[model samples]
Target: MKTTIAVLGAGSWGSVLASVLVQNGHQVRLWTRHPQQAAELNNQHTNQHYMGDYQYPPQLQTLTNLAAVLKNAEVVLFTVPTPAIRSVAEQVVPILHAQKACPLIVHASKGLEQQTHLRISEILTATIPAPYRQEIVALSGPSHAEEVARKDITLITAASTSLAAAQQVQRLFMNNYFRVYTNTDLIGVELGAAFKNVIALGAGALHGLGYGDDAKAALMTRGLAEISRLGVALGAQPLTFIGLSGVGDLIVTCTSIHSRNWRAGNQLGQGKKLTAVIKDMGMVIEGIKTCQSAYELARAQNIDMPITEAIYHVLYEQADIKQEITALMQREGKSESY
Candidate 1:
């Protein structure tokens, strides 16, 4: 059966997922804020800004008109950056009418807003009416867009307040190369998905400094500890961090050369300025911005997250990277188990 999916963002990840849906024999309409980009995709069957090399189906509708694309969508996949989620949600709320049966709303974005400090799901629930609240779900995991777009084997998870909603997404999306799992721990999934990018920056920096695998491994281990600690403090299950969204995502983002966050951190570790690093990477590095938000959340929650704190200083305070490394090394030792 073919389902109609409206993908609300035509970035690399969005385009990749749209193409995946097309592969699954679904009708996919990819929406972009840039009219020119939408025109190109609609006419050329290719997204030059994001997935330039990959060819999409001619049937895939690329539209700048949000209302038309979303009118009767069976599933609405929001793939914009975290910063843009609130405004987009607000804009779409009025268009959500009662006459038509509502669709499942899924968020593929990772990161909390720095100013509002609200997670993506929270933003959706606050913006959408109560009737549509239960339909929201977050789909995330270790799967990278670059790899997944290439039709490589990738595994991801769909989390929702209702297990039935999660299972619906899992059934709708699972494929031979693309595996989807269902989990009810939305907090753990969202937090782990968002925070791992911050740690990936540190991981990339370690590699840039000519650090050995042992050093990178230690940083990743400690980073997960801090992430798990904070996650549990904020109502997430402690063991959720060990699952696909936690350790799975952390390892992939930290080690992959394709990861924008890791690439940005590499430049930073090599002594490039923050502005210069982002300018060179040429894409959204969620981890850099996420570090700031995570730092703020840690402070607000009174949770100790030394790794996130150190990265925040490096990003915003102009702290010397070498000194930051030394500071982490000099911290008092504690029991290995947290």
Candidate 2:
């Protein structure tokens, strides 16, 4: 009953997921691009950079070489950021041939590829061989890495083409404190996962501006509107965005102090520049890239996402935040039902 999992990316989320797998009695091969970091994990059982204070199970093996890990891994879990996915995929495509028989690919990362506008599962499908593509699945939710790392009760969704794929992840990842749910709506889950970060930044910025609950609630509600609008354009079910991966994730990311996107936006709202906020965070703030991509996507699809548009302009076009807010409030009134 022990699943062998190869988890790529050594960031907080990746390490926490690996730790969870180890707790679930799975043999985990934690992979990072840096061999020295892998050596540290193998020898010290701690990721000094990310999960510094947390101790991992002694049974967890750490490796830098993707081939070595993927060779025997029953499931390959991607924990890298969206931007790094292509290069990582290119590096692993050759060895992936060996996994053609019955491979299970699980993408734990969120965010769509900016250039291709493809989701994580889409990237896996395009890059991985045909046999492995069919097995590509995504695990996402409102669960924060920090909370989940502490063994807090967390819920997530594992979505794939096959119902069996979802069940596989549920079995591999579910622990006493971590619960996994299955969904076949891969498009909705992935899009919801990606867009929530952008909305979180907006929500955080609003919070930093000393907005009241009514304003925050409006931002949150309207943010879901934008997510639903664009998600539907891209083939997601309208109702899916209202589920855990959508509204649930938006609420958590926007309100929680643990959210990197929200934190980054807070500093931005407090008048610090983008570069400075990122420098202080010292980790990937996915919303910055997501804002850029989502803006581009909206324009390409002819979707009207005003909040997304406002944030995009403020971040990229040097538009005044106050003016953008006023513009949003003054937009032509229409029936609430869309």
Candidate with best lDDT:
1
Root mean square deviation (Cα) for candidate 1: 1.4
Tens-place lDDT per residue, model 1, 5-96, is 88999998998888888888899898888988888887887877676667777788988888887877888999998988988888777676
Candidate 2 achieves a global lDDT of 0.86
Q: What CA root-mean-square deviation does each model show from the true structure? A: 1.4, 1.6
For model 1 the local lDDT of residue 237 reads 93
Q: Write the per-residue lDDT of candidate 2 for residues 1-338, one digit (tens) a residue.
A: 98888898888899889888988888888888888888888788888777667887888888887888887678888899989887887777777776443368888898988787889888888887776544778899998888897888898899887999899888888778999999988999999999999988888888887887898898999899889999999998888888889998899999999999999878877778887888999998888888888899999999888899899988888777778889999999967664
In candidate 1, which residue ranges exceed 4 Å CA deviation?
98-101, 132-134
TM-score of 2: 0.96
Listed per model in order, the count of residue pairs whose N, CA or C atoms clash below 3 Å is: 0, 0
